[model samples]
Target: MRRLMSIVAILAVCGVIVSSVSLQHHYATSKTEYCDLGETFNCDIVNRSEYSSILGIPVALIGMLGYAAVAGLATVYRERRDTPALLLGGALAGFAFALYLTYIEGRVLGAWCILCLSSLALITSITPLSFVVWVRSRD
Candidate 1:
């Protein structure tokens, strides 16, 4: 179970990396052409919008750090089962943030960065998976 969670954490990190790339592209180009092309997943619009940068730091940077921490903690937890529920809580926390940003992108910015969407989906899935694992262990 720890191994599985660790793998999931790794995948989550990968999703975050993809999101960061898309965001960086938007920041560098400052255009919605490539990202907003599919209409379904418009990284361009989200990246150029006001919400791209939170306070002074870029949202993508935050995601990168967040995901990295998750992956690292998950790995540690995998090795040490005695550890508490920090990773579980962190996963939920990350999911909440991801959901919030995705909402802002889709509603306020009128765009849906594909990479970010994937990251959100990953977090959403992880929350449930982690919960199921935890619950099952209690039994």
Candidate 2:
């Protein structure tokens, strides 16, 4: 079970890394049509919106750091079982933030970024896996 959890965590980390990198690229280039699939789905519109940043820092960058921290904590969890609490907490926080971003994309921007949605999925998956890890660790 521990091995399985580690593998799941690693896969989640990779998924988040890929999504974060893609978002970062979108943020840097400001190429709206890069991931624009249609009128309702546009990466450029969402990434360039005012909600894309917080207090001067790009949200994508913050996501990258958060994912990286989760990865690091997962890696160390093998040595410290109690680390699952931190992992679960971090995953929950990321999940909440992702939900907020989704809301902003749907309600405010009226557009969707593929990369952001992908990150949301990754973090959403991580939350449950981390919860399981935390539960198993308590045993």
Candidate 3:
């Protein structure tokens, strides 16, 4: 179970890293057609929107750091039992943030970024798995 949880966490981390990098690329680019699939789906519109950043930092960069922290916590959980709790907490926070971003994309921006949706999916999956891992560790 522990191995499975670790593998899942690692995979989620990879997904987040890929999505974050792609989002960062889109954010840095001026071309709006990179991920513009249609009227409802457009990465450029979402990434370039005012909601894409928090204060002065890009949200994708924050996601990369958050996912990296989750990965690190999962990797070190074996040596430190309390790391599972931290991993679960981090995953939960990331999941919550992803939800907020999704809401912004849907309600405010009226556009969707594939990379952002993928990161949301990854974080959604990570949250449950992290919870399970933390619960099992407590047993």
lDDT of 2 by residue, 1-139 (tens): 5675676567567766765766666557545455789868888888878988899888887887888888777775556756888888888999999999999999988998888888888888888888888888788
- lDDT values, one for every candidate: 0.71, 0.80, 0.80
Off by over 4 Å in 2: 30-34
Q: Candidate 1, after superposition: displacement of residue 83 in Å?
A: 4.4
lDDT of 1: 0.71
Instruction: For candidate 3, write residues 1-139 as lDDT tens digits.
Output: 6685677667667866766666566557466565789968988888888887799788888888888888777765555868878878888899999999999999998999888888888888888888888888888
TM-score for candidate 3, please give it. Answer: 0.89
TM-score of each: 0.80, 0.88, 0.89
Q: Report the Cα lDDT for residue 57, model 2.
A: 85
Whole-model lDDT for model 3 versus the true structure? 0.80
- Worst window of 10 by summed lDDT in candidate 2: 25-34
Runs off by more than 4 Å, candidate 1: 30-34, 38-40, 81-84, 136-139
Sort the predicted structures by TM-score, highest score first.
3, 2, 1
Of 1 and 3, which scores higher on TM-score?
Answer: 3
Q: Is candidate 2 or candidate 3 better by TM-score?
A: 3
Note the clash tally of each candidate.
0, 0, 0
The best candidate in terms of TM-score: 3
